[model samples]
Target: MNPLTAKRIAATGSAALKLLMPGLCFVVSSLAAAPVSEVAEQFDRHFEQQLVEHHIPGGVYAVIEGNQIVRVRGVGVRARGGDEPVDPYTVFRIASVSKTFAAGLAAVLAEQGYFSWNDPVVNYVPDFSFRSARYNKALQVEHLLAQTTGVIPNAYDNMIEANVLPDRILPHFRQLDPMCTPGECYGYQNVLFSLIEPIVQQTTQKDYATLMQELIFDPLQMATASVGMEPFMNSANKAMPHVRARGGWYQSTVVPSYYRFAPAAGVNASAMDLSHWVMAQLGHYPEVMPEHLLATITDKRVRTVRDLRRGHWRQFIRDAHYALGWRVYQFGDEELVYHGGWVRGFRADVAYSRDRQVGLVILLNAESNIVSELSTYFWSKVFDAIHIAEAEQFSELHSTEDD
Candidate 1:
């Protein structure tokens, strides 16, 4: 062989000899496996690169499919000026993610005949009278969850400022003054849902958080999930909220609300725990779930919001509706149930498609709208990967068909 050709042959021969050796056989075997480490590296790149681009303080994410946690990672810091890095154990204020829990608790009660979807609001809380008599009686549990109660948007900002408990604000339905007749238009009302917290507690004789623990978290073994205020604040694994202001990120301190409103936004949990919650929602593990309750939670009651942003022809959220807590969307043939939350300096998004057996949870401390798009992109990427994997799997299973 020529000198260059001889050198190439020698190198190849040495590499093959090493691979054939007893110790190196293990390395070869690992290499031949499905490249799990490489997959993890790529997944981390996708998460960390997005955080760096968005200036998100730091956050955690988990991907679950078919009752398995395929990926769990934390990127960035615990807070803006903190030296601590986030970990799998880091807890985040799950914001409207709590809404799902609230809605679930409501479902549990509804299944027991505590309340019905079509039940009048005035029946549960006599003080829930609206300015218009027709709207008052027309307002139902379904309407509250559907965001079609003719309430103004974010009407609870001043409510929180006033230190008013949700029950105290029930009488203020008349103050909303019917922006549109009940069921005629959709406008989200955080305070209205918060009111349901007391109703759930009163009807079930169990606190909202406790009911969630028994019905959802405990059953799913989500040990790190909680709606407690003091416990989360004092937990060693918890991350502090961060908000961008004055051209830099600042640590956010917890602000007290009038009453513990675990309904609208109060739960805190890590990504691993959330992935378990998502997997339960997917219904792959049926024994751990209450079938009727799951049906109640996932079933769409009304198409409340028309999702005006996407336009009519391509409106994936066109038939968008709300069950108890989830905002339901249809993408082509897939039905996606999702929720995004923001409170103080925390933001979170959890979305999963029931048809695809795909679930994604992203929790970040930085206050930004970019989290929503990042979360949606992650879900799409995961589903796309699943589709490809399934296609390859089928092709392998039928490889001899053509022969």
Candidate 2:
């Protein structure tokens, strides 16, 4: 909230991060012990012995269970050419991972009766209008969060990239044709998705950033998480994003372009902060993120077969769908709620399984496809370990009957 406090939070980067429990904590059935957990065994070797040795800049990853952060470690420096090592608490812009927080905030407000999901968007921001008067009246708070506005995907996002304000971009929507009737299908959006900002701000009579802080971050104890560019740029122990050029990673300055859409791409957080976020999604904190709220936000709404075909995610994903702000991926019979984010020089992936009570968050300061590969490989191991343990348990039970 304040400059001094933000710096104090950043100062926490120096705290010694420890491996509390690679302690065979992986969950199998209630009656079963897991096949010796191997998901994190080569994690350090992959990052320290491999990624760092390669030309990439920096990143941080944390493994968290529903009730505790299992292990968190940062592998590289905060900036490409600087000596400030990235620790678990080093703040990085999470990009579109901010959408989860936005949707969570909206759900928080909705539960408080500040506004209803079915409420028309025009009630909050009367200035916003669509080409069709019928569609304008039909668009509701839930439609934007669910990505079913029937607007073209990423509508006017290029204007945001060119440093245009959303107010300027809002009027242009009046000129476009609908892709589908409201709530009929899925079409992703950045500028359009953020219409929730005006809705939340107006209904509660609070700024969007302040509401997110009061409702979500504070309740979840995400101390190092902050919204907007000022806190991110002012924080001393923040990760500077990198762009690959001239055969090496180079430090890149944070641009205000995406920050203009705070609800869409402007939240900054540390791995320490986001570990708590992932844990909350696993339903650890009921007061802040209750089961009802979780169910509302992550309830499968629209098919997203395309996301299942992402680079490393394609083969294993049996099905995929979009919820409020999350993606529900069917991994065999288990469900994984997940999202990934990217901007100029950053990439982030957050995912968790409610059934298993395990979650992982990965943040990278440089743009690299390696993050995708690494995330895919880790989750694959976790799923594999679960299956093998179940098979072994079945075999043991069958043998016991024979004996």
Candidate 3:
């Protein structure tokens, strides 16, 4: 290394990252930021190779260590037909990854006494009728975000996909009987989960989007993040969605269906924005996302045994449960907090290991299961590194004691 550059790094008195600028150059805002470690470099190479083999037109992934973006890259073009290159700022529809934001907002409001988790959903949206009044009254604010309302899994999700407005679709809940009472069972729902929107709006007297922006996004400095379809469509650097067919990859227009449920699947972000989000969850931005709020939101509330059978995740995930917006997995002896999103033409996966102070976000324009495989591969290798380090430390300690 040159003396000038080495002197700069040494002066920082912290780990300096040497990022591989394939094409894009990201400026490290702080001198203390860590460089791309061997594992991070390997993960990036494996991910890019997979995207090429899978024909994923364009995507971006960011790796975060502590409060630093150690490594981030954009792979491929914005669309299959375009010459526009993707970048760390190329926004993609994060889909259900939006749930984490919703849950985070709820945690923040609840912490500030805007509302309590124990508050009933009926108190805010009295029109949220169900075939069973007992279950209707029993459903609380926590159940909406926790996926434990005991309603049928993905209840009315088809309707949402059919372009049915939530107002029209939600009333249909009264026709069906709930499988179990609130908090008794785990049943994922885009419509039911989004009920948190009305509850928060009513409690805070602010629109859901504004609340998310003021409370979470702005505080974390997620500059490229925005909510709903209009903002995504308006953004000039957004990654247009894509669909894979037998012939090749094809571009697809972003549908307005899922955007109607803003809390469930309606947020746009770039890899850079998500790096800040990861840092907040890792206890870096405590003023915005305090450790208590993180704990409350990620606290396992319902067992999701079905997660153990997921395509690429089944083997590594020994146990699985749904927290408010996140899924907690027992990967060997470690805890993996994760969430994955799939909307029409996009797929996103975000996972972080708090113990290791590491996080990763993968955003893609195509609807492929590669996101899952890539994330699973990453966590597996991360855990492997942890094991090696611990073993080495143990051996060195014993050797010293013997001497």
TM-score, predicted candidate 1 vs. hidden true structure: 0.78
Clashes of each: 0, 0, 1
**Of candidates 2 and 1, the better by lDDT:** 2
What is candidate 2's lDDT per residue for 236-262, written digit by digit as tens?
A: 889998998888888888899999888
Query: lDDT winner among the candidates?
Result: 3
lDDT (Cα atoms) of all candidates against the true structure:
0.69, 0.80, 0.84
Alpha-carbon shift of residue 257 in model 1 (angstroms): 3.0
| Evaluation by TM-score, superior candidate among 2 and 3 | 3
Give the 10-residue window scoring lowest on summed lDDT in candidate 1: 24-33
What would the TM-score be for candidate 3 when compared with the true structure? 0.86
Best by TM-score: 3
Off by over 4 Å in 2: 1-37, 385-403
- Residue pairs that clash (backbone atoms under 3 angstroms), model 1: none
RMSD of 1: 13.1
Query: RMSD in angstroms, all models?
Result: 13.1, 10.5, 9.1
Better of 1 and 3 by lDDT: 3
